[model samples]
Target: MRPDLELVANLIQTDARVLDLGCGDGELLHNLQQHKSVIGYGLDKDAENIGLCLAKGVNVIEQDLDEGLGNFQDDSFDMVIMTETIQSVHNPLLLLQEMLRVGRECVVTFPNFGHWRCRLHLAASGKMPVSAHLPHRWYDTPNIHLCTFNDFEALCAHLNMLILQRRVVNRHHNERSLINLAPNLFGSYGFYHLGRTT
Candidate 1:
């Protein structure tokens, strides 16, 4: 598992129901089913990834997340997880609302747009940053709604969601003292565990 996924896996309770949005190849789901005994289903739009999921004996569905997760009923799962898929979605606010509606909690991970490297690159070259973390150019990037940690927290506040946990880490998903000093300026990515307050 990716180090970030390792962090995500830690947040889950054993034997819980989970829904993984934009699950690329069912790696996390497979790991969860084996180690945590989690009952989970992965959702993805790519046919090849779906094939890989089936091969792994993972329960998966083919679907575009941008449309909505309407096929699932309310409070259907214990947790809803979306890793690195928020920026690509059409309506992040609605997606989050739906996630919380269908599950008691949600976990989200995304590249930090407010990192110092991105800011420095933009200010220096006057063009969008194209680095290891965000390798795509502006014209071809799948990320449509890139945002900062502060931006996401504000949105959560607007929706009355409670932030259960938050972590800012380097590209390797490792935490260092520098990152803790000023996460917005140092950390390359962010991981958040959230829930409805009400």
Candidate 2:
């Protein structure tokens, strides 16, 4: 399992209802079901991922995230999850709102564009950074709305979303002391657990 997914799995309670958005291959969902006894569903647009999910005997749905989550009832799930997919979405704020509407809480992860490497790359080369976490060329990148940790926090505040937990880690998905002091500069990626404010 990816380190971020492993962390997310730890956050979920046993027997909780989970809906994973952009759930590639349903790996996290499968692990949750096997270990935590959670009721999980995955939504992915990729045909290959759908086949893999079925092979694993995981409940999966074929759907595009850009279309919105109108199918699920409000507060039907204990949690919703979208990993590294926020930047690729067209309207991230709206998507977050939808996630909160359908589930009590949501877990999100994304590459932090404000890290020192990206900033230094821009300063030195005058171009977008191509680091281990963000390996794509600017033209071919799926990250259309790349943002920093601060930016995402601001967005959450704008929506009045309560941040339950936030973790910033390096490219290896390991936490470091420096990252704790200045996450915007040292953190390579960020994982957030959020819920709508009551």
Candidate 3:
């Protein structure tokens, strides 16, 4: 399993129902089912990923997150997760609202566009940054709305969501302690647990 995914799995509660949005290959869902005995569902737009998920015995739905998850009722699952896919979404706020509407909590992770290395590349090279954490050239990248840690936090506040927990990961995907100090400048990626404020 990828180190970032391992960290995500570790944060999820045992026996909770989980819905993984953009769950490529369903590795995290399958792991949760096996280790925690949790019920899991996955949503991905990729047909190949859906097939792969089914082969791994994971329950998966082939759907685009931008269409909204109308099939699921309010608070239908314990958690809804969107990892490494928010930047690609057309309407992130709407997607986030839908996640909150359908689940008790939401887990989201995304590359920090404002990371120091990205900044350095932009300043020195005058070109789009590409690194292990964000390994995509400008024209070919899937990321459309790259965001910083502070930008996401402000959006959460605007959406009336409470940040239950926040963590940062380094380039090697190891957890970092001083993430809150200057997450945009120091962190390579951001992880957040969110819930309704009221």
Candidate 2 per-residue lDDT over residues 118-141, each given as its tens digit? 999999999889998899999999
What are the RMSD figures for all models against the true structure? 0.8, 0.7, 1.4
TM-score of each candidate structure, all chains considered together: 0.98, 0.98, 0.94
Local lDDT at 157 for model 1:
98
lDDT (10s digit) by residue, model 3, range 26-125: 9999999999988889999998999899999999999888888899999999999999999999999899999999999999999999999999999999
Model 2 RMSD, rounded to 1 decimal? 0.7
For candidate 1, write residues 112-188 as lDDT tens digits: 99999999999999999988999999999999999989899999999999999989999988899999999988989
Instruction: For candidate 3, give the lDDT.
Output: 0.91
Q: Which ten residues in a row have the lowest lDDT in candidate 3?
A: 173-182
Supply the global lDDT for candidate 1.
0.94
Off by over 4 Å in 1: none
Locate the minimum summed-lDDT window of 10 residues in model 1.
4-13
Alpha-carbon runs more than 4 Å astray in model 2: none
* Rank by TM-score (best first): 2, 1, 3
Clashing pairs in 2: none
Q: 2 or 3, which is superior by lDDT?
A: 2
Cα lDDT, all candidates: 0.94, 0.95, 0.91
